[model samples]
Target chain A: MFWMTWRQHRLTLASLAVVFLGLAGGYLLSGAAMRGSLSLEAVQKCFVGTPLTCPEWAGVISTDRNLRQTLLPVLPALVGVFLGAPLVSRELEQRTFRYAWTQAITPRHWLTSKVLLLGSAVTLLGAVFAAVYRWWFTPATTGAVTLYDWFDVFDQGVLSFPSACLFAFALGVLAGTLTRRVVLGMGSALVGFLAVFLPLAIWVRPNYLPTLRVDADSYYSQSGGWATDFVYLDRDGNEFGMWEALSRAGVTSTTSFGSEQEELLARAGFREMVDYHPGDRFWVFQLIEAGIFVALAAGCVALTFWLVRRRSV
Target chain B: MTETAIAATRLGKRYGQKWALRDCTLRVPAGRVVGLVGPNGAGKSTLMNLLVGLDRPTTGELDLLGERVGPNRALDRVAYIDQEHTLYRNFRVHEVLKAGRLLNPRWHEQDAVDRLHELNIPLTSKVGRLSGGQRAQVAVAAALARRPDLLILDEPVASLDPVARRDLMATLMAAKADRDCTIVLSSHVVSELERLCDHLVVLDHGEVRLAGDIDDLLDGHRLLTGPAATADRAPVGTCRVVHQERAGDQVSLLVRGAPPAADPAWHARRVNLEELVMHYLASAADTTGGGKHPAVLG
Candidate 1:
């Protein structure tokens, strides 16, 4: 199985080199460009009132805000899709499973060897990317905000990024094992990721976040017909709009207003109120979701192993 | 009792409406090389597949190296060289051999590597780039390297050129000479089987037309030539009449059984392995009425 896997993946070592060089080169050049513009002399003179330049570390961390924000989520997911699609499907496609299964070792041992060997390579690649992201972004405090104090809809934790990537990888493996076609596996994985992510990001959590609601008649009387149109929610650093008063009214049932949200609304004495404002337990939510996603990823990996081991072809 | 290296009793397999192999009972003792010969679609591969545990027999049992090998066989003890190139083409020759070593518990890695070296197969050369004969050699090397107690080959040298075929047969012969591993090889090429096989199992459709020690099969089987009109009557002590053909006054009847020397008018002739196979196939086809869809020998 290692021999077979190596045949498929060994050629990608060159591609790995190219991606690594491209990422580092892009990061370094952006940092250099930022350093040129944000010089200590210029910053001190231009923004003399603000203490933005007190620590040199912050400048280095914020070198390439756009690049970090754009590349972080996309790169790992791409790696997962690229590497996972062929991991098992290639064997079945080639019809070489016959050779492996006829050996003294059971199918379990055969699959275990492949997963242990190839999975280590994937883990190493992900780790290197994570380390680079950590190093390059430690100074540039500007980018997609983490779950530190800000509560953006995408404020998953530090591990969530890799966990998401690993989840995508496992998804790819599962797709390949089940479908036994590289193109189909890749397509299914991409489709599944979008299917899960779009709903979770756009619909589920946002509506669930603590919100404030008011009757259109009363609020519109006070603020003019503005209450009938929409309500733009600003919770932590994230912003979203509920379309019209009717949609905003549904937000109460969606978020499942907890005791804390109920108490806050009671203090304010509002008719309808669900607010996802900043709170201490936001990090706890991040940890819990990360755990769930990571556990899901683990389950996907386990299922792939089972399917590959048992499949006749 | 002398241990039988391989045994199949009432082995049967059917695919949909077609019976690929049925009621196949044969035994080859330890250290004997068995040749399973038949026409294309004659259940040779099906029987081999059943023995190797690649496909289960629909009705019967197979015992290999003392273990019943249907659902609970120790598959590792048996080495199967499939009819196609089983090696991953993208892997190097050395790596393919390494995979054999990793998968088989009793692999004779050095012997396999040495044979590959002798054949001048490149260790670092990828299998995809190798010639057809060379690719075949790599598969053979992997099978032989495992030093399995029973080596089952299905059309082992089907695609090789004449010279490569000779060399491969020589290598297989040498392996059998070194260790008394039972080798059961299936081939349509009877000439090749004549060189190495000690036991014979002749199949037509899904049934065994004839089977026994090579000497016994050859001795008991004969082709008799007489007038076309004389062919209608069965020969005395005839077990089976393979085929009958006529040209004017001359009629050739391929028969299985010893003919009396006293019969002067009827000529009794011995048949080689190839001639015997042709006769069986021709007769098997004739019984099916010589149509495009030949009836399987039930």
Candidate 2:
């Protein structure tokens, strides 16, 4: 079974690995170059008055945001389209499954063994991407950003990201089993990968741990946390709208704010409160997300087993 | 060794509203070359699929080599080639044989290699590049090398030209000469099995029409020819007319059970295997609202 799987998909697997490794190498090199000239230590030493001028540690962070917006929806599902979708769909579509299943082994065993070997290949590559991606943005994430920025890093961490890859592969198998069409299965895998992770990212993840509320004098004190929402309360301790506070401070227009905006809001009889998840809970959220995806992956694998056993084709 | 190789008790398969096969009960004895004969959609492939465990029965029981049709039960002892003659077109011919060796618990690499060499099939050529006849030979070589106790081929020669069909059957007969395997081959063409099979099973519209030893089936029935005017009258003794056709003023009827041939009313001759199979299939078509429709309209 192992030989057959490899023999059939060696070219596809090799191409995917090359593409993933190339992307990883690019990210690592660009990340290292971000801090090559002006190291963080130089910025620290400038404060000692030796160099007198602080050379800013300029790390490109906008690309990371773009990746989160664009690449993430399609990245992990590449394995689904190239590897997992065609795993069973090819056999079924081409009618080679009739030949494969009638051997000494059972169809369930044939499908299960092939999926395990190939699933491990994708998961290993996904780990490489996760570790490299997290390292790629390490300088920017730790230098001047809030701990809330670490949430994005955790999304690309070993636990969560690799689980998404495995989940997508398993979903591709299930789609192939259901539809028995190679193209349709690949499409479903891509769509399902986003349908699951997009909702988790938007609504389910932040709720994994309860939000910590903080009373801080200035926004700087809450910089390291994921500041999801801000509440403006009058001295009477009742929450008021931000627009009301701005208008009461005689802010005629909403378009621009001066450097003294904090003082203006403070003078409007408002105290600031923040609801956030601390940066220290990074691994905890990673584990939660990974557990959910892995659980779903296991369900798809088990269902594929049952389907292959009873499948007439 | 004389035990039944395949036994199905009231086996049936229904897809949605239509039944592809229904109430099909059969027992094929071990070591006999059996022909499962039927017309298109006569449940021949359906029965073969059930024997090979490719399909589950909607009702009733099926046993292959005294074992239930489940994963890995009788699988090692059974080999099946579907109607399409499935193979991985991407792999080389030798790689296909290697796959057979790797997949089966019992491997006969020498036998497969020797057979292919004898057939002059190029081992290095990709299966996709091989001719249809060569591909079919490779499939047969792999199957025969498995040394299964029961070999089921579903419409094995349906796609082959006459020469390929003859070559494939020759190889099969040569393999059957030595092995103790029971072969159940399904074909819509009766002439193909007339020269190959010892036992016969005929089906029509998902039901069993006739089944027994080929010689026994032939001997148990006789063809009676007489005037068309007397065709409506029953024959002498317990003989029953299975099928009949008219030409000019004469009508010939296939009668089951031996009638007294010495009677002066009609001429009696022994029925051939093709005649027996065609009569059963034709009579089945008659009862199923299909036969003689054009004739009646004309």
Q: For every model shown, what is its TM-score relative to the native structure?
A: 0.73, 0.91
Per-residue lDDT over B65-136 for candidate 1, one digit per residue giving the tens place of the 0 to 100 score: 788774434477688888775788878888887777766778888987898889898899999999878887
DockQ of each: 0.46, 0.63
Evaluated on chain B only, what are the TM-scores of all the candidate structures, in order?
A: 0.90, 0.95
lDDT per residue for candidate 1 within A194-309, as digits (tens), equals: 66655654565444334445543444333211111233333332323432322433434444546564345434333442233333544555565567567877888789766643
Q: How well does candidate 2 score on lDDT at residue A19?
A: 72
What's the residue-level lDDT of A134 in candidate 2? 75
Which consecutive 10 residues in model 2 chain B have the weakest lDDT in total? B289-298
- Estimate, for each residue in A65-156, the C-alpha lDDT of model 2 and write its tens digit: 67766885457788887787888888999989889888888877787788889889988988998888877655445554323366755667
Whole-model lDDT per candidate: 0.67, 0.80
Model 2 chain A TM-score equals: 0.84
Give the least accurate 10-residue stretch of model 2 chain A, judged by summed lDDT: A43-52
Model 2 C-alpha lDDT versus the unseen true structure: 0.80
The numbered model that scores best in TM-score is 2
